[model samples]
Target: MALKLYNTLTRRKEEFRPVNPPQVKFYVCGPTVYDYIHLGNARVFIVFDVIRRYLQHRGYRVMLVQNYTDIDDKMIQRAAEQGFTVPELAERFIDAYEADVRALKVKPADIQPRATGHIPQIIALIGRLVEKRAAYPSGGDVYFDTAGYENYGALSHQKREELLAGARVDPGEKKRNPLDFVLWKQKKPGEPAWDSPWGAGRPGWHIECSAMAMHYLSETIDLHAGGADLIFPHHENEIAQSTAATGSPFARYWLHAGYLNIDDAKMSKSLGNVLTVRELVKEHHPLDLRFLILSAHYRSPLNFNSELVEASRSGRQRLQEMVDNLNRALPGAGAASAAAESRLQAALEQARFRFTEAMDDDFNTAGAVAVLFELGRDCNIYLKEGYPYQRGLLEKAIGFYREANKILDILEMENPGELEHDIREAIARREKARCRKDWTEADRIRDALLARGVILEDTPYGTRWKKKA
Candidate 1:
C-alpha cells in the first residue's frame, strides 16, 4: 500500500506520490527569528521533521528546505525596540531558535534558507508577478492581484464571499481585492532598508517563503507544511504568488500540524502566555513533550499544562523502561521456546505491518503510537517466556521501534557522540548528588543535563536520563 498524507488543501488523506520518483522535495516554514521559538513552533518542527525522516526511511532521498523569515515586520520592529541592527537581532534569535529545536530533537533540514539570503529571488519573483499583471505596485507597496488568480482561495477552501465576511475591511479597500495580500511593503522611516526595484524596502511576510522555497527546492515542492494557523492568508498567499508566476501546482501535498492551546485557548504571542521551547524543556523533558504530542493526532489541538506534562513524563518513563528492559531481555541465557519464537515473529510482523499501515494513512502518528504501545504489551508477554534469543528477532523489534519513531520523530536512542565524557560525568555527579540528598547539587547537575539536551528523571528505580528532544 502507498503512504498516505493528510493534505490541508483537500481536507482529506490522499495517497502520497512524488512528482519525481525516488526524490522528495519538502519545504516547511521555519521560524521568524525575532525571538526564541515557542513550544508551538517546536511542535510544527518536530512533526514535519518526522515526516521528512520517514520519507527518507522509506527510501526516498528527501531534499528538505525550511526558510527563516529573518526580515519580516516583526524582526524590523523588534530590532528597533532593542536598539540592535536587523541582522544582529535576527542572528541572535536565529541561534536561539536552532538551539531550541535541536534540544527538541528536530533534525536540521537539508537546506535552511533565510529570507534575507534570497532577496534577489524574492525580487525576481515579485517582478514576474508584476509583469504578468498578477501583482501591482500601489503607493510604493506591491500586492498580489487576488482577483486575477482563478484559484486564489482554492488552498484555503474559503470562497470570495467567505473571505469578505471575515475580512471586515472593504474588498475594494486594497490594491485589487479585500483578499489581496501584500508581496512587498514600502519601507517606513527608521526601519531597516533593502535596495529593491520598488525602492529601499523589505520583503513582505508571504513572499519570503515562496521565494525561498523556489530558490532552494525548485518551483514546486513535493510537500509544503506548516502550522494550521498558516493555512489561511499565509499559505493561501504562497499558492497565489508561486502559482501566479509558474502556473503549476505549488505543492503536491500541504501538511499542517494542529495548534497548541493553553487552558483551552490557543497559545499566541498576542495572548502573552506563549511558552518558548526553552521554557517548556526547563519544566519537562523533550522526549516527554514528544510523547505528549504523539499521544494525540497531529490534526488535533494539544492542550498543554504542567500537570499534563508530568503525566507525559510518567508515560514516557514507563515506555522507555519497557524498551530498555526488552533490549536487556533479548540477549538471554536459556534456549528459546519454539512457540515463543514463533509467536514473537508473528507479533513483530503484525506490529511492523500495523506501524507502516498507520503511517501510510495520512501519517497517522496517533495510530502509529497506539500500535507501538501494543507492541510493547506483546513484548512484555514475550519477556515472561524466555526465548531462544534469536538475534534477528531482537533486531527486528528494535528496527521496528526505531522506524516507527522516525515517523513520529520521538524516540531518542542514546548516541555515543551525544554522550561525551562531560555529560557522563554530569550524570554520575547527578546520581551521586541525588543519593546524598544534596538538593542544591542535584539541581545543579540537572541544569547541566539540560545544557547537554538530556533531562534527568527521578523514578522509584533511580535516576534515568533521556535526551531533551
Candidate 2:
C-alpha cells in the first residue's frame, strides 16, 4: 500500500506524493526563540522528526526546513526585560532549543533559517504583495488586504463572513478589514527595526514564516507542519500572504500535531504548570517523553501528568529489557533452526507490516508503538519456550528491534563491554550457581542484580540480564 498522510488543508488522508518524485521539500514552523521551548513545542518537533525519518526510510530524500522567528514582539519585550541585545537573546534561546530538542532525538532540519537573516527575502516578498495590490502601506506600516484574497480563511475552514464577524482591529491599528494582518510593522522606539520600503520596521510574525519557508524550499512545497494552535492566525495568514504573492499553492500538505495539556488544564505561565524540556529531562528520560507523546495519535490532545510519564518510563524500560534479553541469548545459541528461523522471520515481517500500515495511515504513531510491543512479545516467547538456540533467529529479532528503533528512537542500550567488571563478575557468579543447582546462591545473586536495577530472566539457552528503568 502507498504511504498516506492526513492533510489539514484537504481535511482528509491522501496518498503522499512529493512535488518532485523521490524528493520532499518539507517546512515546519520553529519556535519564536524568545525563551526555553516547552513541552507543547516538543510534540510538534518530535512528530515531524519521526515523519521525516519514516519518509527517509521509505527512500525519499527529504529536505526539511524549519524556520526560527528570531525577531518578534515577544523577543523584543523579553530581551529588554533581560537587559540583552535582541540578537543576543535570540541566539541564546535558539541554542537552547537545539540542545533540548536534540535530547529528544529530533534531528536538525536541513535548513534552519532565522527571520532576521533573510531580510532581503522578506522585503522582496512583501514588495511583490504590495505591487500586486494584495497589501497596502499606511503610515509606514504594511498590512495584507484580506479582501484581496478570495479564499482568505480557506485553510482554517472559516467563512470570510464569520471571520469578519469575530475579528476586531486592535487599538492603534489601521487596516481596511478586521481580518487584515500585518505584513510589516512600523518602528517603535527601543524596538529592533530594519529598513524596508514602507519604513524602518521589522517583519510581522506571519510574514517571517512565508519569507523563510519560500526562500529555503520554494513558493510551492510538499509539506508544511506545526502545532494545531498555529492553524488560525499564524498558518492562515501565511497562506494568504504567500499564495497571494506567488499565485501558487503555498504547501500541498499541511500537518499539525495536537496540544500538550498539563493535568487537563491548558499549559500556561499564570497556572505555573508550563513544563520545559530542560526541566522535564532532569527527572524523566527524554525517550520517556517521546514515548508518551507517541502514545496518542498526533492529532489528538495529550494530557501531561506524572502518572502518564511514569507509564511511558515503564513501557520504555520493558522494550529495553526485551532487547537486552534477546541480545544476551545470542552468545550461547547454536546453529540456525529452520523452524525457529521461519517463525521469527514471519513474526518480524508481520510486525513490520503492521508498523508500516499504522504509519501510512496518517502517521499513526500510537498504532506504530503497539507494533513495537507486539514484536517484543514475539521475541520474548521465542526466547523462553520456542528456542533450540537458533542464532539466526535471535539475530533477526535483534535486527527488527534496531530497525524499529530508527523511527521510535526510544531504545538506547549500554554496550555490554562497557559493563563494569563487578557487574560482569556477578553475571558469571549467577551462572556458576545455576550450574551447581544452588538455588539459594542463584536467588541471592539475582536479588543483588535487582538492587542495581538489573533484571535476570532464565531462557531455554541460558539466563540473560537487563537493566531496569
Indicate which candidate wins on TM-score.
Answer: 2
What is the Cα-based TM-score of model 1? 0.85
Off by over 4 Å in 2: 337-342, 413-418, 430-463
State candidate 2's TM-score: 0.94
Give all TM-scores, in the order shown.
0.85, 0.94
lDDT score, candidate 1: 0.81
Query: Considering only N, C-alpha and C atoms within 3 Å, which residue pairs clash in candidate 1?
Result: 104-469, 286-468, 336-387, 336-388
Q: Residue by residue across 28-100, what tens digits does model 1's lDDT show? A: 9988888888878888988888778778878999999898888877888888899999899988988898888
Model 1, residue 381: what's the lDDT? 66
lDDT of each: 0.81, 0.89
Q: Per-prediction RMSD in angstroms?
A: 6.5, 2.0
